[model samples]
Target: MEVLGHRGSRVPGPENTVEAVDAALRAGADGVEIDVRRSADGDLVCVHDARLSRPAGRAIVRQPTEALRARGIPLLDEILDVWAGRGRLICEIKNQPGQPDFDAPRERTARALAERLRARGWTGPRPTVADLDAGAGGITVSSFDWFAIEAL
Candidate 1:
């Protein structure tokens, strides 16, 4: 059985941070499951909540990457830089409930994710979680919001 870490084990350090990812890998995790949300500046952030209640008092969609980083949030690229090709990534795209322009967020997130993957040299067709979990070298996107998944 593959041992996938939740937010990179989330113990020795904050969830989704580079440190937590390293910790999980050191502890024998084959891969990690992380939450991804788009920030105000259209950058992808690795976080679980829509609102930054724990990290800050602002909404994640309204906070830029710089601001989120100041509050200890990790950018998706940062995590990818650390784990790319080393382990599997189960990326859970966060949903925007009760937010106006819900579809916009999904679109932006998908675009950013696609751009990042392409920039990282992924030229093949998008792969599924089963593919990545079966040893594909990139990421697999998932979401609680079926609409978001469908939009991708």
Candidate 2:
């Protein structure tokens, strides 16, 4: 079994930041499971919330990638680049029921995810790995949204 870190380890730094992810790897995590969400400009960002209440005081979809990054949010691509050959990545797409942006018209989200994964040459069905470093270990996208599952 693989020992993956949750949100890049809940120990050092913020939950989903690049710093935290790197720390997880250093601390002996085989891989990291991070959250994925779309920003206002359609860029994929690493964050667990559909909205940030304290710092941004706004919805995540309403903010751009740059602004969120300035506030400490990291982009999905950044994580991918770093983890490409070093470790595995499990991407959990965030979708909450009753949320405004979590409803229909999710094709864009699916497409964006596909594009990013494809860029990294990650395709085919789900992988079964004995360890995180086994095989062509790329990112895996999972979500609670049934529609998203169907769409993807």
Q: What are the lDDT scores of the predictions, listed in order? A: 0.78, 0.78
Q: Candidate 1: lDDT of 50?
A: 76
Q: lDDT score, residue 99, model 1?
A: 53
User: Which whole-number lDDT from 0 to 100 does residue 97 have in model 1?
Assistant: 62
Measured against the true structure, the TM-scores of the candidates, in listed sequence, are 0.83, 0.86
Off by over 4 Å in 2: 125-136
TM-score of 1: 0.83
Tens-digit lDDT track of model 1 for 110-152: 6677688789886477668787667765567887777666766
Pairs of colliding residues, candidate 1: none
